[model samples]
Target chain A: MKFGIGMFGDSGYDTKTNRFRDPEKRLKEIVEEVIQADTLGIDLFAMGEHHREDYVVSSPETMLAALSTVTKNIILSSGVNVISSADPVKLFQDYAMIDLLSGQRAEIMAGRGSFIESFPLFGQNLNDYNELFAEKLNLLLRLNKEEKINWKGTFRAPLKDQTIFPRPKREIPVWIAVGGTPTSVLRAAQLGLPIMFAIIGGNPRQFLPLVDYYKEQYALAGHAKDKMEIGVHAHTYIGDSRQAVLKAYYPAYSFQMNRIGKERGWSGSFTQSQFEAGMSMQGALYMGSAEEVTEKLINTIELFGLTRYIAHI
Target chain B: MKFGIGMFGDSGYDTKTNRFRDPEKRLKEIVEEVIQADTLGIDLFAMGEHHREDYVVSSPETMLAALSTVTKNIILSSGVNVISSADPVKLFQDYAMIDLLSGQRAEIMAGRGSFIESFPLFGQNLNDYNELFAEKLNLLLRLNKEEKINWKGTFRAPLKDQTIFPRPKREIPVWIAVGGTPTSVLRAAQLGLPIMFAIIGGNPRQFLPLVDYYKEQYALAGHAKDKMEIGVHAHTYIGDSRQAVLKAYYPAYSFQMNRIGKERGWSGSFTQSQFEAGMSMQGALYMGSAEEVTEKLINTIELFGLTRYIAHI
Candidate 1:
């Protein structure tokens, strides 16, 4: 099993005011953290892409490229590459370039990014969300496997015998980042792509059934059972004590959760009990000392038979 | 005056020959070199975006984000963002995000990238090349200054009061990259934008007149003299000995120059005299000991009265 840390490059927000530090300074600290992780034997370090002010990484590929120069041995991946909002060809080219810099250590997880800001900002329609992902995903998959792709899609222009440059030495590994969508899960399984289950909240046991469903679908699609690997994405922090972890992480996590909840029509406040419940329950928040995290991770892996675990630290 | 270094992240044809280290390992060394430069008081570090297999950094922003986390105080900038091949909205969002990560120290140089692969790969037309850059440049400018933009163009769909998120704390610095095109120079001056001169080969004195032309155009465009900064982008290296610098750089340099020459109807096989001319003549290549580079830079600055000297080391 592989363990990786994912950061949105969030510098953490001041809870009372919901404000962030100077982004430049915060980002510098984030890069330092990645270097520290690499030295600590962390297997992978991933950054998420966000177009909102609270999240600092809008160009994950570029950030990865810069990181390539600084760190060694750690696999570099993206928590999400907002596929529905970006050009698939450019994404392919960008990742390929990163692969070259990082020596084929580049990987990406594609999804419809968590926010709606990308739609209007990129002149994309939210109504065609499903079709957009579908068409773009097909194109992205084609670009990933073939050097010369002849593709036509409704969301973008058509390509006739187009070959992207800086092709990876080998096939670049790709995973689908799905946030609780059965249809998306089925789609990933049907395509025989690895699944990264983004379990931000709720019990981890609940996701076991989804994992089972994915395996069944993969089997139905005639893919080998041994070919699939299920992974979990969780929010985490490791400190000397649980109190230290909570004190350092909860305010920012609550603020961000509430901000997202306000947009998605969920309850906004993070009650003390609810926070404790989330920490204690078999859910995705992997916070505490390193020992506690390792134990919980092992348990979760056993429960879901997950081969990989990614934490948004 | 600032000293920086640029490298084609990929080793290209030398991959099988053991002439260059693998991309990942080489990048780790490069990052260490940049850190060393930072400590040595180098002012800026820029990475170019290239789609060809030989040149590796297709996603400069991703790499920068990773660098933002590790380094301190040095200015982080992209050598070039291919505005012609990339979506302006996405480009703006990515850079703005970089600003957030880098504490508002992020800047970008926009250009119609040197390579042609991006054209067909991204489904853009070579016929509308000028129009693509013009519109994209205009859009990029607007997106940089304003939070909400309502724009329509032939290259992209119409936006109705669209706002790009993750806005920078201040107006993100932008420069137009030019490769000796009078129209490009005029366009940048007309827009009150700074110019990044790509001085690949030839005498630096030849570009002095073009610098004068830009200042003249800026005055004609009704902009203040203090508003424009001319940055020279050149291939560079610093070593303990002049002989050592040549020994390490010449083979890779010749390899790249020959490849480019092949497509442009130039002859194969780079000669030692040509390399010597570029190094000794006041041209683009900045190769030699640190003292040699610093002296040349000061001389160039005094002669040109330039604001920034971006060395492509």
Candidate 2:
């Protein structure tokens, strides 16, 4: 199976002093980490876009473009490019540039961003969020399908037989990143695009119907099965001992979950006990010793027929 | 004065049949050219933007981003980023990305663009061209000036107290590129921004008044004279000898000029006589042996007090 890792540049907090790594240092460290990942036979190293006070990267393509040089074989991708709040023409041009610089090792992961701050920041209304994404994705696909485009949409300016320059030498990979929305899954499947399921939480097995449904729809739609690959994205950690991994990751994971929960108004705290339960065999968390985590991954892949797996560390 | 060159792919013609270089080869050649410039003690190597079949680069940041990784000390710049047809927020992020990768060596040359093709391509009206540029320039300046912006404008979506991330460690230089527009020069001077003038045709002495007016206005506007830099961008070629450079560059320049002139409906055949005359001491073009061109540049600098000279070779 193809393996990848997401470099989120997740702010590290000292369980001892409650301090976070400096943003600049965190960004530079991330560059080093991705360069290291390239030497480890990793197939892909994607950077996710998050516009927040806690996160460092707001533009994933920028980070990926920076990593294009030091990297040898690892495919550089935007874990998600938040297409809902972006100008797709410009976005396409940036990725095309990355493709040229990286010797065609560029990929785009389009998603309706988890954080809604970009909607207002880019002067997009939340009511038209999905519509914006659908329209932009359509335009982006048209750009990919051909050099010149004649497209009209409600959100963005219409293109009239316009061609984006610095076009890629090859058709770069375009994956649809979704978070358990059946409509999103069906859309990707109907369009014959690869689906990247973000199983960050909840019972991972509960999403079986969605992946199976996607495959059936993809096949029914008559896309080549050999060319299709479904991927799963999970938060994972591997330590020498299960207990050590649990102890080290629990506090940091709890801090992050609490922060996200607070932002989303979840009304409940994610305690260490909940974390322990999530680390169980059927749990969404992949926190454990290498052997245990690897066993769980094998089972999950067999269960879902996943061809690609991305673990965010 | 600082010396820089525009790494224009120049689309080499088949000297025998007058066929242009393929776009891919043109782009690859540009990368090598810029790398050569860096090792040759050049202070800056910039790439200009063009949206046409004959031109390879439409997004300068894309090219600059790629060059940032290979070069050591040479500054990477968009010789002109057609800001009039671009979104300032996206433009800021791309250039900021370049700056971070290049170790604070990113510069942006903002221009209204010599070619009008982008206006319709980007869904902008020709009638509102200058107004669109003015509005976008204001937004770009505001983004450059502050981290958190509460900006409103007619051309673009309004931002309500939002921050543009990955702000450059040091302020990246932004120069106003103009083609003999007195009003544009006055605007740049009023804003205390450097002016990059295009002296492509006619007698170069004709612009002495404009440059003098800019300096007077710049001083009157309370900007330090020492901090002020006015640049001249001219067509230049330095070869083994005057005859060799002329014979080599004339055919290609003629092909390009005829192509552009045809597009703009300017019926003018630039014959060898006119080309030779244009290379005279008082003429705008800077072509000949290195010694002759260097002497001309020295004399021109003494005459206009130019702080930067960019040759589009």
Q: For this target, which candidate reaches the highest DockQ against the unseen true structure?
A: 2
Per model, kept true contacts as a fraction are 0.67, 0.37
Give the residue spans of candidate 2 off by over 4 A: A11-23, B10-22
Q: Please, what are the lDDT tens digits per residue for candidate 2 over residues B1-313?
A: 8989985455566657765555556666777788888999899887888776566677888788778777889988887989999988888877776787677899999999887777876788889889999999999998888988998899888998888666666677899998999989999999999998889988888899999999999999999989999999899998899899777988888877887788788877778877887788888889999998999899889888999999987
Predicted complexes: DockQ each: 0.44, 0.47
Which digits, one per residue and each the tens of the lDDT, describe model 2 over residues A108-146? 999998888788767799999889889999988989988
lDDT of 1 by residue, A1-313 (tens): 8889998877567756657766666666777888899999999988888776676667778677667767788899988888898888878877876786677789988887777677776778999998899899999899888887888889888998876665667788889999989999999999999999998888888888889999999889999888798999898778887788778877767777787778788965776567767777465678877888778888889988898998877
Model 2 preserves the real interface contacts to a fraction of: 0.37
Cα misplacement distance, residue A195 of candidate 2 (Å): 0.9
